[model samples]
Target: MGRELLNFKMFLSVLFAFTVGYAIITYGRLVREEIGRYDRALSERVQVIERVKAKPITVKGLYLTASSAASSRTRQRIIELIKETELNSVIIDIKDYTGNILYDSDLDLVNQLDTERVVMREVKEIINEFHNADIYVVARQTVFQDPALAQAQPEWAITTEGGGLWRDYKGLSWVDPTKPEVWQYNFAVAREASKLGFDEINFDYVRFPSDGNIRTAVYANLEGSKAETMRKFFKTLDESLQRSRVYTSLDLFGMVLESGDFDLNIGQTLAVALDTVDYICPMTYPSHYPTGHLGLANPADHPYIVVSNGLKKSQTAFAKAERTQLRPWVQAFNLGAVYDGPKIRAQITAIEEADRTSGWMLWNASNNYDSRGLLPDEHAAALRSDVTT
Candidate 1:
């Protein structure tokens, strides 16, 4: 009887051991499968995030009508030109060359001041029209060089050595870029523009006034170098526009591309500026580059080689370092008084030759695009026809 009992106890112990071992193996397998599923889910999420960021549609076109002779009557013709030229994008001058607010700024300060001189009476209507026409509208805010704002708020103006407002060659006074107050003001306008449903905000004159005597001008009481100030302003702008859900682009001087480093006087560093904005539009207009750049006697005369080489060098620099985006501004205006179809096409070809997949915006200050009837035969066929959408 004792021997039988012992045998039963041994058998029961063995069964219990086997059951625990099986449970351990099952649990291990379940954990492994769960980990595998998690990894796949994480990878899919990452892919979705990347796709959200990297779907490439062409963000190209022309800086249009506000800076042009195109009147409201010519709106249909202008839209027609956009279709005809194969250009789907238009940078409308919400604020223009003169310090006039093109639209009624809803900001309390602006409205209270009655600053809506020369307002575009039908801006929202026009934008809606353009949207229906399948055109993307970018609000071009001329930063820093705002005489209207400066004249109204002289305290914000950059002062000269003699304690007076400094004027550039164009007799324009600029707000001090160093002042956070100035940044707040400009950013307020940007926020308002964003609320108005602009697809993007293109900051022009986003730099210190370099046309004046940098040596004699006195900046506001601000710490850090000029480049740092510029970077900070960009950062501030970026922060301001972050909530807008729109792409932000900065208009930089063409020289910033070729210059070995950021022009401190103008407060622009390619690398630093690129960090803050979605697109860095180095106005790589051949007319802006000095004579004898890349062995070209006249940069304006040789638009293709000048812009191509300049952009190539810039791209190489960007690649060597860590530049995320570069959208160079090619010349659309006549520098040497030679505004023709060939000049326009040459600029486009040079941009294409540089191997950048994105498109370019032709900037004619007059807003009159004579090239509308003329595009390279190759591009003419690809122009989208359904503007009513």
Candidate 2:
């Protein structure tokens, strides 16, 4: 009987030892998982902090196309003109309204176009030269409405009701913004531009196809509101750019100033976009406005009044928001308006006259600018007299 009791006691001892071993193993796994979860949460929090601190260097610039005046002699003259005009900045078109890329883009599909004849091979050298002159370089990339990319990746392009790639008045098809893959493609391009040493990456046509068949167009994914999709695109680009430490800016329609309506079906909201970008350039070109705005007919004819009032409204709207800069794209092109040096001066003065803090960039499609028009006799005289004094 004593021997039987001894055997039972040994069995209980063995059972207790097994239970203790199991408890230790389970507790160790739980502790390891808890540590892993904490580590992931901490890593994500650090990333967020890093993004909030990202900012762009400030600049005052002019819009220029390297390919517009590709001749070496013209490029030299432009360099001299830029220095003479006291313009220390240039927004060169890396891409344009058309699907053509100005530089040699290694983007697998862009290479197949065989349109390499149109590129400015010395783009990197020119950019470096501009940097040497204390000039800021802004690489302008047009997104969303790339017919070139659409032709290459039709599966990624937006389609119309008739089951064809949607065409705008210019006969160009756009990449559907609703598709995240489309956003990824464009953002990848922007990232590459940033890596190439562009001081800032200015995304244009970052919205939906404005001139396309709006009514019949069908998004491949049809995910969210236009504004929401735009926000997602902007946020994705913004985050991607954060690691590169490059500044980002976007061009918004002038109408965004009046109504504050971002869903003008183009996915542009001033408030939401401004939060993620460094500078917000409202194409406040007076010529683009309707005949009557701010109770003025033919806003383009009166550059001073149009720019002044529009800037004043922008100043008010932006003042209540967070932004690093409020630069405005001034009119340098002849959009059916007789604009001369006096008119250009008026536009500059209007911006200055409003006491708003920002730089002004002149836009001329031909790459030919009337320097005389930009510097009126009065300002010239004032500059000379001040220098002598």
Candidate 3:
């Protein structure tokens, strides 16, 4: 009877051990599968985050108008330049100087007040082509100098002390920067550009109108100094674009660099722009500088001197301000002096000497970058390698 009891005990022990082992194996398989699933999910989230992050972009670039971007042949020519040189970016006009949008937008305000500026057939596809080539695309929106908007909305325009629409020197009308409606109109365009995959949104003519009789102009809504008005506008714009996944830049007069207290009497100062925007672009074109600028006999004739001195001021001004980068505008057209490859490169060299990390841009109103070798071979090669690798 004792022997029989021992046999039964041994059988029970074996059966209990087998059951525990089977449960352990099953639990191990389930844990491994769950871990694998978590890793995959984490990886997908990482990719999505990367997509939303502002793209790493360098601004060795040229400017193209809306018309230029619409034409396949013109775009192809610029693409060839990008392929051949250190040029890896282009600023296309989403809102031209005339206050017209370049692409079709569904904004009700844009349709009811002013017409939509849709000239390109495949706007998004065009942007994709450039993006695929690793070219950074910046949407240039001409802000305060919208003639079309002013004409459509006369109530929002700068008024003469006599209550008529104030016109600039070019006979072009300007909208008041203080108007909240004006802010909404421009921000809506910026939102559209962000949605269309532009890496950057650059604001041109962000200040009050610089041209025409300043003494006679009357602003009914301006409650602060011109600088303060511009500052408020920029701050409002920055806040309004909170939902966008892009970088913002403001174009300022080159002289804006020389004075901390002055906004060229047009309502834009270096400090105010730096405080609010991601990038500050000084229109440092040598030809645009007046005679005796920076103590030069003719500033345009000495492109290097003008660019270097102007950039020095920019460097000093930016030294005090943190977070914003300086990207100066270099002349690409034949203006006061013949801007050849070397002359163009002289401005670029000046920019490098000032700050190598900051990028420089070229502007030719005619849409022609005749200086094919504007970028140095070594720099071009380095830029190309960066894209390829």
Score residue 192 of candidate 1 by CA lDDT. Answer: 80
How well does each candidate superpose onto the true structure, as a TM-score? 0.78, 0.77, 0.83
42-86 in candidate 3: lDDT tens per residue? Answer: 999977855363556668988998889989898888887887777
Best-matching candidate per lDDT: 3
Model 1: per-residue lDDT, tens digit, 289-363?
666777767878888877777677677557743324666675777786485778778877877777532677878
Q: Which stretches of candidate 1 lie over 4 Å from their true place?
A: 1-56, 67-70, 320-324, 355-357, 372-389
Candidate 2 residue-wise lDDT, 1-389, digit = tens: 99999999999999999999999999999999999999999999977755222234435467777575345676667666666664667788887766567776677645764422356676777777777766778889888878877777777888877778988888888888888877777676777666566788888898987775689888887676888888878878788777765777888886776556546878887666766887777787889888877677788888888777766766556776664456777888778487677777787777666643467778777777747555433545677789999
Residue 335 displacement in candidate 1 (angstroms): 2.1
* Clash list (residue pairs), candidate 3: none
Segments of candidate 3 deviating more than 4 angstroms: 1-51, 371-373, 376-389
Instruction: Go through the candidates in order and give the clash count of each.
Output: 1, 1, 0
- Order of the predicted models by TM-score, top scorer first: 3, 1, 2
In candidate 1, the residue pairs with backbone N, CA or C atoms under 3 Å apart (3 or more residues apart, or in different chains) clash, namely: 68-366
Q: Pick the candidate with the highest TM-score.
A: 3
